[model samples]
Target chain A: MIKTKIWVIVISLILTVSAALSVIIFTLPKKNVVAIYSDGELLREIDLSEVAEPYTFKVEHGDGFNEILVERGRIRVSFADCPDRCCVNYGWYYGGASPVVCIPHKLVIKAVNSQKDDFDVVTG
Target chain B: MKTKRIALDAVLTALALSVFIIEQQIPLPIPVPGVKLGLSNVVTLFALFAVSPLDALLILSLRIGIGNVFAGSVTGLIFSAAGGLLCYVTELILYKFLTDRQIWVCGVFGAIAHGVGQIFAAVGVSATAEIFIYLPVLILCGIVTGALTGSLAQVSVIKLKKVFPFLPFRRKKEEKQN
Candidate 1:
């Protein structure tokens, strides 16, 4: 019991430090992607590049997961019906590192980039 | 002790698998992606004390294998095996020093260990550190669920001694049954 308590305290401290360190290390702003979100009532868009006007996607809002295509420039989750709005987490539509994920609504906006044809991981 | 050990462990493993399958159907209020109560671990705790360590390992493997198959996710098999292996190893190590009264702590640690193992598997599958963001949440869930499962296992250990007194309590009865 004494040993177990000691182990717990030590492990707890180690876990805390690692978790905090990871958060600090990974919050860097990623620049090469665009993310989008909208309700049937409102549409919001952001672009990877600081341009005068980003390309617009066409779509109508309904009570389900909705996707709007940004063509060759960039892509975003046009809209979703679910509440958590995880589609926003999937930051952009063109990189291997980030896949736009919508956790609450179970919607995803996948980025299709023509530059790289090879994928490093196959999630089986 | 040798032959009876095999049979008892087999039964406990099957029981754990049944509990795992049943618990899968009862949805949780919070829809965190991979969290679970692990109620089936009660059978594991029982087998740990009542049977030999080798027998306990067999039960753990069987329970994990059967649970994954029943849940219909072959992808989950790696996580189940890794998590189960870590939990079983931790429980065995904890039992060496702690008494049955201290089983709750073992349960807590087992849960954390299981979460760590699962995350390791997830990192491989997801291929992104973004998935690691959920580790703390998973660990908290592990501690909570581990304590619950541990308490239930403790109660079952006590009750089984009374109901099946001869099976668990008596050396003579064990010999005769064997």
Candidate 2:
């Protein structure tokens, strides 16, 4: 009986926390081309809207990680030496609910818009 | 006692590893990565109660090591190893407080702890806090799966002791009367 109650409490807590988190994550400001940092150094500024030509860049940062991405209109991480390979599988997420993530390598390619709209990727 | 326990642990680890591998072949409907049913945990729970704590640890380590190879991803291994270790530690703590019949509580806490560990790993690896958005969904899944696996472990233990009257957990102590 106690165990059941504990489970109930735990489930409710997780549900409550998850619901609040979803609201925060969804309502939080969003941006396209918010900011780009490589190896703790700012790389060339990215203009998501004006991207017309496809290009690839090599990013080796804190860890000796190799990353290659084919970015044209929509930026995508085409390849990475990271073992997880989640980012590679995420495949060109231009705009969506969540960011394309590669856990093994702390690399995030976010969609940003310069025109201040409803969401500001980061609450600045 | 030590050698017999080691042999038993080795066998249990091999069985759990096989289950872990077989489970991977069954794909998930959720697109999110690193989520699993972890049915192999049933065996781990059994080892925890039926065998010694060290034996259970051995089985868990072996399962995580071999299971990752079959999953074909090093990332999964990292997530599993960290999560599994955290869960095992929590289970050990809970096992002391809860009776054998109440093992389900241990399971629930272990599952939540596992989720927390995975999220911690995800945040560290991805370098993006935005991934935190998935936590709610993952937590719900964890509860459901954790409860299911916990119940499965409970039923297995109840039934096994019935069939194997000679099981160590039920063995009668030898008397030293004159």
Candidate 3:
């Protein structure tokens, strides 16, 4: 049986590492330009600054579809066929940090500088 | 072979699913997605300690399946399936080394594994590295929630073992004493 002391150490270690990682992630500079991605390909680039009217569109994959709503300076997944609408929950992405991700639809909507492009995709 | 085992699995599945459904009704104070009490995990931990691995697996899948039907979208099922499997496997592996008192450790492991697994699935399906930015947030949430659930499971394991001496957690020697 694993000792309580060992677990205590493990827990403390995890807590420390998580805290450090969070700090690093939060401190990173927030960028501009909301990019809509499907299956790792850059489907559309929406310049948040140039948006005149909000619009809705669908990103269709082999399995299902996600209806995305783009506003003046943000983006959101309005509807989805996947069981969990995580992307939808992403709400209005004003871009402090973090992107809205939909696993089933293979979608990621994030605010990054127009030049910051390169996605690390893991294959099944 | 025993009717009791079947009944137990069914009950556990129901319990986990209800916990899942109820959790959704409660408003999330945190705006971020995928953060919750994860109460159903307590039941899974209980089953892992009280029953066999296969039994625990059965309860887990049933909970995920029913949970998806009642409260989740298909996309959620995919993420949960990936995350939940990782959580179970982490706990199952840790079971061998952990003393009964250290079950919470398993909880922490399961929590981190869940985050990592979901991230992997998200990255795979989306085929983009951009989602990686959410990793730190997810991992931090995992540590907090895992500790809470792990501690709860630890308490249940300690008390339940006495009430049901037939549970797999009992050692052959301890069984004789009881």
Candidate 4:
């Protein structure tokens, strides 16, 4: 049987590595393009850098909807009808690796590197 | 013996459910979804070490199923079920390798598996592979919270065994043979 000290050291190593990785990922450079997805389908793609005016739009999925607010360089779910309101609480998406997600509504807003736009061209 | 086992399972299920409900009310500062203290897991951990693995599994399933009915959404159920299932399996496997004193190790790894399972469910439901970005932060949160809850389970198992020696704890049986 492995000793308890061995288990402690192993788990501590994992904990430290993940903590360092999280810091690195969070601090990585921000992107300019953001994609809005509902039920895996791309609903809208906005280049945050190009937004001249702030606006709010509603994306409805069945009985629920997310009110998304977009400013010049950031986007956020300003309101959501979902029970948890996790998306709205997520505050804003400013082109980070992490995407704002609402599991209930199957909605996700994520940053996309503009260069990759050619691969998955947005469809009307 | 069967009746005693059933009664114990029911009580542990209730305890897990109550913890699940109360945990929902405590607002977490982090806005990221699928992140919580998961204190209810303490009961499951205790059950796994002190009680039988079968008892642990029963209590976990009941807590996930009924707990969702009371305070969760349909989608929430899917996430909880996925996470709980993965976490239980991880703990079950680890249980054999570690002694009772090392239950905390099970907690840490089990919590990490739970995070991974939740991420898979989230990606599948949303159809967004980018959701993987949350993996690192989720794992980080899992380590911290898992350690806390695991230690809680370790202490509970030790103390509760002393207080209620009649309960069918696996450790008690092992001690008798030794």
Q: What lDDT does the true structure give each of the candidates?
A: 0.64, 0.68, 0.78, 0.86
Residue B49 C-alpha lDDT in model 1:
60
Please list, in the order the candidates appear, how each scores on TM-score for chain B only.
0.86, 0.85, 0.88, 0.94
Ranking by lDDT: 4, 3, 2, 1
* Residue range B24-64, candidate 3, lDDT tens digits: 78776754456666778898988887676788899999988
Error of 4 at A115 (Å): 20
* Fraction of native A-B contacts kept, per candidate: 0.12, 0.46, 0.69, 0.69
- Model 3 reproduces what portion of true contacts? 0.69
Docking class of 4: acceptable
lDDT by residue for model 2 (A43-66), tens: 555655455677777777656454
The C-alpha TM-scores of every prediction are: 0.61, 0.63, 0.67, 0.71
- Alpha carbon deviation, residue B127, candidate 3 (Å): 2.7
Error of 4 at B25 (Å): 1.1
Clashes of each: 7, 8, 13, 0
Question: i-RMS values of the candidates, in order?
Answer: 8.1, 8.4, 3.9, 3.2
Ten-residue region with minimum lDDT total, candidate 4 chain B: B169-178
lDDT of 4 at A67: 96
TM-score of 3: 0.67
Model 3 segments more than 4 A misplaced: A34-124, B166-178
lDDT by residue for model 3 (A4-109), tens: 7767887788788878987887776544588789999999888775677999999998879999888776778899989888777778776545678899888988
lDDT string, candidate 1, A24-92, tens digits: 534633334343433322244444433345555544445455555454445666555557655644444
State the local distance difference test value for candidate 3: 0.78
